[model samples]
Target: MTPLLDVRELVVRYGDFTAVDRVSFPVGAGETLALNGPSGCGKSSTALAVLQLRRPDAGEVLFEGRELTTLTERELRPIRPRMQPVFQDPYGSLSPRHRIRDAVAEPLKVQGRWNDTDGPTRVAELLDRVGLDPSYGDRHPHELSGGQCQRAGIARALASEPRLLVLDEPVSALDPSVRAGVLNLLADLQDDLGLGYLFICHDRAVVRHFADRAIEMREGRVTSG
Candidate 1:
């Protein structure tokens, strides 16, 4: 069977600097493929390239059988919703000015799936699905704890009904006490949705506990798996 996401000889460069080089990997449905490495190891760059947020300098990003690198922005728009990102720094990922409800609702609106009648309900459901109380939607990012903010971000990602999630150090900033809760929530979501995860994390312990398989990187190249 085909994988949900496949990256072949991916390379990302900036002027004289190369951030990711000749990296290849595949994430299968319901599997968590962790990109494990320290800072400046090209994990985040790979994630961005896979999402096409920053197109790779060379190589192919195949998502559900489509090559994303060759697609124009217009052609990529519809495909974007099926693969979402959950970034590190929970608070930084969300806009402080917007209520959580509006943040979650924006994806629906952008995807042309929003209706005044069911939109609010859907947002509430997403919040609840991620372990947030629906009423918490009225609050802004500043009103939430790190863990709660991350949950809110996950809710926003879920709003897109994504099949794959590129999780970039998702719990690194959270308090240790709450990290397990958030990780457990993610595992539950993956189990329930059969979602493929490109989980980028520097913590080996976390990666061992959370990821089904891990690929280690150093300086932009895949060192081992």
Candidate 2:
């Protein structure tokens, strides 16, 4: 089967500083590939490069067999829906001023698909899908707990019906008890939605519980161990 996403010898650098060095991996359809490493080991950098949020000094990123490195931002617009990301910090990612409904619907609105009548209903459905109460749509991000806020972020990521979701330390910010709940929720979502996940995390326990395959990184490179 063809891989859903492929990274070949990906190298990301900031002037003289190298953040990601020659990392390569493939995430097959419906599989979770975990990048396990300590902080600043280039896991997040690799993900950002794949999403074209950061330009790589060298190497290639292919989504569905097309090279993303060669594509302009305008050319990448349509493909953006295929590679949605759920960030590490729910609070940092969300706009404190926007209601949950607006936060979840922002992607759709940006894509120019929002209709006044159906937007709220769709937003509610997404919130509910991620285990948030539909009624919480009226609440702002600050009002929700960390886990609930993360759930809301997940809902927003899924709003685009993405095939591959880059989950960057998704459960790290939650309390220990809340961590398992969110991790299980992610596993369930992957199983039910047939979504591929590139799970970037430092916790081996979480990776062991949720990932299909694990890749360990050190000093900006994939390690043999």
Candidate 3:
């Protein structure tokens, strides 16, 4: 079978600076592909390019055989829910004003799902899926611990039933004490939901424990893993 997500010869630049050079990889169902690199190695750029949130200077971002790089934002709208992101800073990514349920429900609302009979039910299920109590939906970001906030973020991402998750340092911001729990939750989610993951991180230890396969980058190019 074709890979669920493929980045072939991907290149990105900032004016004269080339941030990602000919990077390529594939992520299959329920598998983890870790893109490991130090700061400024373009790992984040590659992740965003795959999602078409960042434009690539040249390359192919193939999601289930569709060429994403050529799609306009309007054209890419439907594809967005299929590939969601969980960023490093959970608190910053979420709206301080919105309660947890609303945050998770927003994606469904964006897709015109608010009127669906099971919209509320789905939100509850997603919160449960991410290991958060469904009752916590009433809480705001400040009311939750960092781990709880990240779990809520993941719940929000999963609200769309995403098949591939672009986790950009997903566990990096949480307390080290809680990192293992969050990573374990991600692992469980992959198994339970059959989700593919493109994990961008700088930690080798994390990769060793979390990823099914790994690639390393340095100075804007794939080095080794």
The number of the candidate with the highest TM-score is 1
Residue by residue across 1-100, what tens digits does model 3's lDDT show? 9999989999999999999999988899899999998999999999988988889999999998899999988999999999999999989989999999
Instruction: Give the number of the best model, judged by lDDT.
Output: 1
True-structure lDDT of candidate 3: 0.93
Writing each residue's lDDT as its tens digit, candidate 2 over 1-225 gives 679999999999988999999999999988999999999899999999988999899999999999999988999999998899999899999999999898899999999989999988899999989999999999999999999999999999998989999999999989999999998898899899999999999999988888999999998999953
- lDDT of every predicted structure (CA atoms): 0.96, 0.93, 0.93
Candidate 1: tens digits of C-alpha lDDT, residues 1-225: 999999999999999899999999999999999999999999999999999999999999999999999999999999999999999999999999999999999999998999999999999999999999999999999999999999999999999999999999999999898999999999999999999999999999999999999999999999999
At residue 173, candidate 3 shows an lDDT of 86
The lDDT ranking, best first, is: 1, 3, 2
After best superposition, candidate 2 residue 197: deviation in angstroms? 0.3
TM-score attained by model 3: 0.97
lDDT of 2: 0.93
Off by over 4 Å in 2: none
